[model samples]
Each structure stands twice: as structure tokens, then as C-alpha cells.
Target: MESPGRLPYRRLMIYLDRLGYLLGLEGVALLRAFREDGSDRAFVEARIAEIRRLLDTPALAEAGGVTAEPGAVSMAEVYAAWAPHYDAGGNQMIDSEQPVVRSILDGLPVGVALDAACGTGRHTAYLAELGHQVIGIDRSPDMLAHARARLPGASLLEADLHRLPLPDDAVDTVVCALALVHVPDLARALAEFARVLRPGGHLVISDPHLLSAYLAPRKERTSADGRPALVADHHRPLSDYLAAALPLGFQVRRCAEPRRPALPLVAGTRPPESLPPHGAWDIMYWCPEAANAAMENTPVAVVWHFQLS
Candidate 1:
């Protein structure tokens, strides 16, 4: 039997193969590569070569190919494992999202600010530096502990974004950064943001871009009972945001989708023997050329600035 977190090699191989096809590799095109009399001899040869490698590689045949699929853990559970190194590790989504978010924040007049789902008080600290009286709220105690240490003087509460612990028309600015993708629905959290903001108060949000989320593999974790589980990360299309916000009387001030920084093509080298394929950037080892071609310059995150009207 497969171990709880051990994914099948076939699944991993299929994923890479699909990515290769999407990137115009592996004889996917009818006339150029798949046809017997096709002109692109190199393309046909490359696809056959890849197929043989996929079938025979020791790494692909190994017991745990990728982390196990699609199970879910609570936000609290997800952050419990991540809190210690949340800021230590670099995140591409955050890298692309922060500058746009800050640029929007910089233009807005600062006042009382609420940082909803404010993990580690990252933006809360920024809001404070901008002279806003900031209150930070998050659901995960593990993340809140880090936030408390980072902003000793600020009001930090254990709360959910769906039910922010603030009164109507309470603040002039609300910032929720890199948290909405974990939310099952954007409506309730957005409604909460709308409720707490005074008329014309600014709301800034940044989420993992839907395309980025779709392309990335689901994060794997262990459930409390030792079953395979996935960290909850949902892909909400850009239209979903508009539908939710427009109903709540928000006017779009600005929206930005920031592309990931370009990645250099990787050599045909294997990943470290110690790490799982799911380990950060390790899966690229399977088919580095196609991975590079498919992922380079893809949008990593979406940032929005809205004003309650």
C-alpha cells in the first residue's frame, strides 16, 4: 500500500507530461510532431526520448513521487506548520504582490487601519509606519504569536476574516494580504471589509493569482489522524472578486496582476536525493526545459484596491 503522503509515480509523470504538451513539447502538435511524416523530426524524437525516460527513471519509480493529493486541513493547521519559517522563506506570490500592494497603500490617506488575516503583522507594521492606528486580526494562534512579537504595541486579535472584530465604519483602510486564496468564498470576507470601512475607506487585497494557483501543485500535509491532506488553497477567478465586491458597493480603484520574476532554464540535473519532488522547485528536475518554458513570466499574484462608495 502507498504511504499516506506518498503519491504515485504515474500521477507525477502525467503532470510533467501535461505541462510539456502545454508548452508545445513532446509531439503534441498534429502536423509538426505527432504525424508520422511530420517535418519536425527533432520534436518527434524528443517526445519519444522523454517517454522512454518517464517510463524507466529510477526517481519516477521510487515509492513517493510527490506529496499525496487534495486532502484538506484547517487554516490553523496549515499555519501551525508554516509559522516558524513563514517570513524566513521567500514566497514568489508575496514577492510579486507586495510592491503593488504597498504602492496602493502609499497613495491612500492613512487613518485607522485594519489588517485582516494579518499573518505575522507584516502589513500591520507597514500601516503603523505610515501613521495609521493599526489593528491586526488572524485566525491562527501560531501566526498571531509571531504577529504579537513583531508588533508589541499594536492591537492583535485572534479572529477570522469572515467575522472581523470591528464595528461598522470603524476604519479608513483595510488590508488583507495573500490570504484570500485560502478562503472558500470571497463574499463574506469582502462583506466584512465593506462593513468596517467608513464610506470612501480604502480596501487593499492581494491573493495568489488564479492561474498561478491552477498551475502550482496542491500543497500536501498530514491530517490529525495521519491521513493525507492538502493545505487549503482555492483558485478564485478574477471575475469572482468583481462579482463579490461590486455587490458590496465597492468601486475598483486599481487592480494589478504581477508576473513572477523570470527563472533561468535549468540544466538536466537531478534534485537532491534527500528531498521529495514536491520540495520547493524540485519537480523542475523531471523536465527542466518544459517547466522553464511553461512557467517563466507567469503572473504570481493579483492585487486590488477598492473604495467603499
Candidate 2:
């Protein structure tokens, strides 16, 4: 009795596309009418009820996470509030990036090193452990508070990456990770890093890949009061970094672009393996299908190593 344009098969194909986009099993079970499988509608209903119950439970983080009133906040304020949960959340970058930085720094010389735009001193602490005089710099006082707590002995400063306070030739190495994506003027920041480093010093940077920018990347976190907060990031092509750094006396020595690891499958979704070999399956966002088709084979994060010339 249905019209040909609105036939079940055509409608089902469209639903399948939307269903698999960054959703978990609980989301699939909520739309009870779409259970074409006919295998077990009761199981679907039971799972949805269980999910609802779990959502009703109170979380301790909700009590302490949000502190400000219901209003807009700056990125600095967001990090200030997010410091408590910074390392505890689903940040896939910290895990994927540390190894890359460690691998590049393994055989390189270590002297006075700057953790440019250091957040919470994670890399700063690691650099100090490796026998470098580590100086951590960030613009946020609240973020610096957490960094200071973790690295009392290391010199921590409240400063902006755009204008590093140190004198020229002050350090032998600088590690700027995952922070460049937020900078509007990459050239100025790169110049500042170069200005402080002694000639031949190493500069390592890790940033979100350009594809994420093309797809419009956003950072989401819970405010101190448990409200959703979003931060925007700017993405530039990896080549742009190389171009901006070269004229500033940085000689590119190494580069790595690593894609995210595969994620778990959700209900009613085609197994990831069923997609075309080049189609993306790990990006945890919803981009237009055409964009996915074009970028599925590209990496999602980029790390670069440069030596000051």
C-alpha cells in the first residue's frame, strides 16, 4: 500500500546510514519501530529500559564538575574547569601522541626544554624525568595551578605561546604538542619557538590532522557544573606547518600522521569491515558521507620534528 518513492527498502537504507553514526547500542534499541529483525522485540525494549535506568543514576563528577553560572565561558575558563577531568576522560590524543614524542626524543639531545602551551604539565613532568630543565608555560592561571601541583620543582610560568618570555637561545629543545590547532597565527608562534631555541635545537609539534578541520572539529567537555561546553579548533594542512617553520630556520627531520584506532561496533550497523577498504570507520564524528568517502584513507593526527638551523 505504500508509495514507490517511500518504499520500506529505500527508507531502511537511509535509516541505516544515520543509525551507525557515532552511536552506541543503547541508541539503536530506543527506536523500537525500526527493529526489522523480528528476532526479539522484547530484548530491545528491555535493553532500552536498562539504559534509561543507568542514565537516571547520579554521578559524583556532576556534583563538582561545574562551578560557574549558566552562561558562556572562554577556552581558558573551560580548561580551568576541565583540569580535574583532563586526564580521566576519553581523550584519545594523549595516548596516541606521547609515544610519538618519546620516539622522536629518544636519541635527541636534552638540555633546557620548554613545554610550550603546556597543559597540566603532563609532558613537562616527563621531560624533567628525562633530565631536562623543564619550563612549563600556559596562559591560564587555573591550568597552571594543576601543572604546578604536579611539577613543583619544575619552573612553571603563566605566559602565552604567542609571546614566550624567555630570551633567545635560552633552551636546547621545545615540545609543543596538540596546542597549535588553537593558534590563529602559526607563523608567529613558530617564530617564537625558534627565537628561544639554540641553533640546532629540536622542536617537536603534534596537532590534529587537517581532515578533522575540514570536517569542522570541536572539543566537548562537561563544565564544572556538568553542563556541556564546546571549544573550537582551527586546522591547517601539514604542509602549512612545514612552510611556516622552514623560513624560520626549522629544518624538517621527521613527520608522522597516525589515524585513530578502530572503535567498537554498535547495534544495527554494518560491520566496519564491510565498508569499502578506503572508507573511514574510526572517525568519531558525523561528516557528510561524501567527505568520508574522500578522506577515509587519510590519517587523523599529525606529529612533526624539526631541528633549528
- lDDT, each prediction: 0.74, 0.67
lDDT of 1: 0.74
**Which residue ranges in model 2 land beyond 4 Å of their true spot?**
1-73, 215-232, 267-298
lDDT of 1 by residue, 1-309 (tens): 245786742233222232332233222332332434533666546556765775576655553333443434577887888899999857777778888998998988979999999998888999899999999999999999999999997899998888888899999999999899878768988999999999999999998887676556544566677855566556788999999999999999999999976565464666456534343456555655545544556788899999999
Candidate 1 wrong stretches, greater than 4 Å: 1-48, 62-71, 271-280
Model 1 residue 265 CA deviation (Å) reads 5.1
lDDT of candidate model 2 versus the reference: 0.67
Candidate 2 matches the true fold with a TM-score of 0.66
Candidate 2 displacement at residue 60 in angstroms = 31
TM-score of candidate 1 versus the correct structure, residues matched by position: 0.82
Per-residue lDDT of model 2, residues 1-309, tens digit only: 245776442122111122222233344334323544442666556555644543453431122222222223356877777788886856766766778988887767879999998998888888888889899999878878888989886799988889999999999989998898878689999999999999999999999888645432233344556655434445788778978999998998999987655433343333233222111334322222222332333466799999998
